[model samples]
Target chain A: MIRIFKIALRNLLRYKRRTMLTSLLITLGIVLVILFSGLAGSFKAMMIGQITDSSLSQMQIHKKGYVSSIDTMPLNLTLDTNKYQKIEELLSSNTEILAWTPRIKLNAMLSNFTDTTNIRLNAINPEKEILVCPDVGSRMTFDKGREPGTLLNPGEVIIPEKLAKGMNLNIGDPIVLVANNKDGSVNGLNFKVAGVIESILGPQGKEGYMHIKDAQELLRMDEPEVIEIAIRLHNFDRLDKVYAAVSSKLTGFINKKGVPEFEIHTWDELSPFANIAIMIDFMTITMKIIMIAIVLISILNVMMMSVYERIREIGTMSAIGTSPSKIMSLFLAEGLLLGLISAIVGNIIGLGGIFILNIYKISFAFGRQENLLLSPTVNITELLWVSGIVLLIAIFASLQPAYKASRMEPVDALGHV
Target chain B: MALVQIENVSKIYQTGDVEVAALSDINLSIEKSAFVSFVGPSGSGKTTMLNMIGCLDMPTKGKILVDGKQVDTFNRKERAAFRGNVIGFIFQSFNLFPVLTAYENIEYPLVLIKNEPAEKRKDMILDVLDSVGMIDQKNKFPDQLSGGQKQRIAIARALVTQPKLVMADEPTANLDKQSSINVIRLMREMKDKFGTTFIFSTHDPRIMEEAEITHTLVDGKLT
Candidate 1:
């Protein structure tokens, strides 16, 4: 076997130019796969991170009807505070959940005494909200004054830069908020802009940030309460375990009518753009198909040509008592060596691509994001899978021609011109 | 005692319903340690007979025995093993593997047939290289060697396994006169030194004169 391998290697080296050219095609194809994988993987991580960390935590517990009518920011379907506290007790028992925050959602019309615009307002506990989403603090920068920790002594608002710019409002400026409560009464609250922070990506950016106390008072939640819980886990990779823990605790504990009081959702379930994941997978699959075609055609072409040119050598080996299996091994060894070399070299180039991206500092807006930094990642498993597949496919492509050469009659092969 | 026996052997090749007889009713016996030659015109069954004796092809009719083992009875793998162990071949084209150095080509047979150890294989390869006066050219590839040198290495490759018989088909057909004489002379000397039977087919009179016994074939029949 070693002798056959040595001959195979020498045969490949004998056709130096052709070997390099064939290997180059394989290397380039794998490089494309690896680079695309890294970029696509980074997009997934970045997008998921933005949705989970900067806005919604990993999971949410909402009243069943709240999601269906969430666009209008309905207050009627919010979880009852008393019922939620019971679930919260169950959730607190799970060590996987690091932090949790209860929120009051309100839809109100905001005016700066000059112009009015409608907004989705999230009323959150200042202390717990920051712990659930630390990115909020990083995004917080005062256009004029320091943002408050929570509620800012009440009657304070933290608005998106886009909203602040549109309303022509500045820090410390008094604003009026008009609200409609579940009690069929219209009311209004007077408030001052506390700070203007950078917008979060995706739909969360469209919200008007506020304290839970302000929402409770404005919407008259004490009259008829509406509250939902957002939760963060210690390790996001443990999302399934934590989601299941909370879900099991909440499910089967139903009201008299056999209706579950609460519904559980992962961030992916709640976000409308979750289909982006399926799209990324489709893109990777398409890339794989194209890579296989390129590699298969290239290896088949080169190996067939190698067999054609070495017919007499094949005959000589056969005549001198080399077995057909050994002959096949010689040729397949060439194909395998090519694949191994190409895959390894291609991975190096792919990693270099990541390094190049880092050096150039690539940041682009994806969907509603303005400046999303892509940290192109190299998942070793994904890299190995692509390379391994390419190598295997290359051997497959070499199979027919190698078998053909091996099975050739030595008499006829030697007689070949 | 005979080392090779051909018993009423005939080979017929069919191409698209047209049958071509390449060898007909061949009966011959080759004794051990003899220099023998089969002389014939092109397409007169010289190469075909050689192929049969080497167990490279089974006769369509009759039986061929190499060292008393029936060639027709060996399966594909068995035939390959028989060919590897019992018969060696040198060809008209000096068909050395182009990529391998002269030493490596000579060492190849031992690797394939015997799986000989490195030290033993090296010694055997060197012995043949010395016999052919090609020890200094061991590292040169086929393309770098002259035609005579290439055939010398081809002979060395054929002899490396110490087979019962070494079959040569037009071994001197491609060489110049001096190179041809040198290769034939080397084969004869190696046969005498190793006491290995040598049976070659050739039309060259010089090669025919070197053989101790000659069998002539014309139109697929021994004449």
Candidate 2:
């Protein structure tokens, strides 16, 4: 077997120019796949990280039917004090639950003395919210008089950038928030603007953050109610496992109507940015298909030509008692060697390209998120899979030509001039 | 016992709408360890006779037995195995694998067909290469050697397998007069040393004169 392989290698070397050209074409295809995989993979991962860490935590839990009517901000559908306590206990006992925070999401009227407009506000405990959404504080832009990382306090609110700009409001400026509680009662609270928060969904988003205590007072809620509970897991890759475990544990809790009261959702279910991530995956698969086609065509063409040019040699080998199977294997071996060598070369150059990309630290923005650096890198298993696919395609492409060469009649083949 | 027995063999080739008889009603036998030659003009079926005897082609109407085995009835794979194990072939073109050195060409049959051990194969190849008087050119590729050297390597390759019979179709057709004499002499020497039968076809009267048993074929009939 080794002797035949050596012969196959020598035969490939006999056509130095043709072999090099074919190998270069295959190598370039492999390099393209690897580079695209690295860049697109990194881009998808970074975008998911930004969305999960700043906007949507890894998963969320809410009262049944709440998400369907989320636009209405229905206060009556909020989880009651007892339900909230039970969920808090469940979250605290689960090891995979790194953090969880409750929020009272509602629409309120914002009054800056001269201008009044509607705004969506999420009332949260500053310290707990930061744990669930660690990058949330990083989105805040504080003025000269305020600290950078310091989030909302009991009497301060962080308004949206568009609202702050439109209403001509600044940090430390006093503002009034008016809200209608669940019982058709109206109340208002006064607070100072702590900072301005940037929206990751672009400039169209108008949402603000406030302290839970102030929101409770403004809505005149005697018992704390939560519209939603955001959850953060220790490992995002285990989101499905943790979500399943949490869902199964929470399944036993039934409301008086005898139905599950809560719905659990992963970050992807709650965000539209997941579609963009899916599109990126689709493009990656398309790129791989293109690479496979390139390998198939190049290898098939080269092997066919090799067989055509070596017909007499094949006939001589056949006449000398080399089996048809051995003849077929000879051609296959040439293709395998070509694929293996070219894949190795392509992998080295591709990984080097990724390394250069990382060294340069290319940055691009999606929506309002700016300067998101692309750290392009591929794992070992992925690299091996790409190489293995190319090798398989190369062998598959050589099959017909090899079979044709093996089946030739030695008498007729020898008679060729 | 005869190493090869041909009984009433005939071959007909079909070309489009026409049928041509290349060989008809031929009967012959070759004894063991004999240096035999089939001499004829062009289109006299000399190659067809050699082809049938070597199991490279089948007779249309008769049976061929080589070393007591019916070779004409063998399947394609069986014929290949038979050729690899029981017979060796030499071509007029000195068809050495260009990518292989002379030594490797000689080692080809032993490794690929005989499955011989490395130590034994090395000894067998070197002995044959030395007997052909081309041992010093063993490392050179076919293109680097003269036509005579290439033919010597081809003879070495054929004898390395130690088969009972070696068939050469026009073995000296491509060599000069001196080279042709040297190749015929080397083949004769190999037959004497290895006790292998040598059957070849040629149009050259001088080369035919060297064969111990020369059969003349005219118009597909042996005379």
Clashes of each: 0, 0
User: Ten consecutive residues with minimal summed lDDT in candidate 2 chain B?
Assistant: B126-135
DockQ of each: 0.74, 0.87
lDDT of 2 by residue, B34-53 (tens): 99999989999999999999
RMSD of each: 2.4, 1.8
In candidate 2, the residue pairs with backbone N, CA or C atoms under 3 Å apart (3 or more residues apart, or in different chains) clash, namely: none
Specify the highest-TM-score model's number. Answer: 2
The deviation in Å at residue B80 for candidate 2 is: 1.3
**Alpha carbon deviation, residue A113, candidate 1 (Å):** 4.7
* Candidate 1 docking quality: incorrect, acceptable, medium or high: medium
Local error of candidate 2 at A48, Å?
0.8
Put down candidate 1 lDDT per residue, A1-417, tens digits, no spaces. 777777788888898999999889888988888888778878887778877877777788888767767777777777676777787788888988899988888888999988999877878887888788777765655544454554344778877778899899888889998899877788889998887767655556567778778787887766435467888999988998878878887886787888887888888888755789778878988988898998899889999999999898888788778899988989998888888888999999989998898777678987556777877888888888998898899899999999998898887788889
Each prediction's whole-model lDDT (CA):
0.85, 0.90
| Model 2 docking category | high
DockQ of 2: 0.87
The candidate that achieves the highest lDDT relative to the unseen native structure: 2
